[model samples]
Target: MHKKVKVKPNSKQQKIEEQPDGSLTVHLKSPPVDGKANEELIKLLSDKFDVPKSYIRIKSGLSSRQKLVEIDKEG
Candidate 1:
């Protein structure tokens, strides 16, 4: 399933919190600029969901605090 994530980067540790509106709060140490934070978020989600990294895609919010990701998996 696809999920909407709000990214809070440059933190001390990485964390993921799922909200009631089907969104997520992702925290990572990588800075938000230069795509570092986005990369970290994708990696974390891929590992957390046990899905391939290729299956995780940031569909929106590249330059914003909020993001939309599409998780497409095939079995």
Candidate 2:
């Protein structure tokens, strides 16, 4: 499955919110430096979807606040 995620890095708390438009808003405790936010994003998605971190891949926007992610359906 593919998901559109908007990340708010360096947040006081970590959370994931699903919007009415079907996109996701993710708050991460990690900063957006040296892939820390990306790692946190993968871990959060993995836990949320019951999949491994390896099952999620950032398809685009590696350095931007918005990102497109590809998630394996097999889990």
Candidate 3:
């Protein structure tokens, strides 16, 4: 599955919120440095979808707030 997500790094709490527009808002306690936020995002998504962290890939926006996430269906 592919999801459109808006990420907020350096947040006090880590959370995922489904937006009315069908996108997702992700808050991560990790800072947007050294790929820490991305790693945290993958971990969170993996937990939420019951998949392995390696099964989640950031398809786009690697350095931006808005990101496209791809989850391996076979996982």
Candidate 4:
């Protein structure tokens, strides 16, 4: 599955909120430096979807707040 995620880095806590439009708002504790926030995002999504970390990939927006993530459930 592919998800549109809006990432808020350097948050006090980590959390994920599902939007009505089938997107996600993710608050991450890690700062957006050296791909830390992206790593955190993949970890969070992995737990939420009951998948391994390797099953998640950031399809786009590597250097932006808005990202497109792909979750390979069959993996």
lDDT of 4 by residue, 1-75 (tens): 899999999999999999999999999999999999999999999999999999999999999999999999998
Best by lDDT: 4
Model 4 earns a TM-score of 0.98
lDDT string for model 1 (1-75, tens) is: 889899998889999998998899999999988888888998999988999999998898988888889988872
Per-residue error at 21 for model 4, in Å?
A: 0.2
Q: Per-residue alpha-carbon lDDT of model 2 for 1-75, expressed as tens digits?
A: 899999999999999999998889999999999999999999999999998888899999999999999999685
Better of 2 and 4 by TM-score: 4
**Over the full model, what C-alpha lDDT does candidate 1 score relative to the true structure?**
0.89
lDDT of 3 by residue, 41-72 (tens): 99999999899898999999999999999999
Best-first order by TM-score: 4, 2, 3, 1
Provide the clash count, candidate 3.
Answer: 0
Give the TM-score comparing model 1 with the true structure, all chains together: 0.92
Q: In candidate 3, which residue ranges exceed 4 Å CA deviation?
A: none
TM-score per candidate, chains pooled = 0.92, 0.96, 0.95, 0.98
Cα error of candidate 2 at position 7, Å: 0.3
Off by over 4 Å in 1: none
Tell me how far the alpha carbon of residue 40 in candidate 1 is from the true structure, in angstroms, after superposition.
Answer: 0.1
Looking at candidate 3, the ten consecutive residues that score lowest on lDDT are 66-75
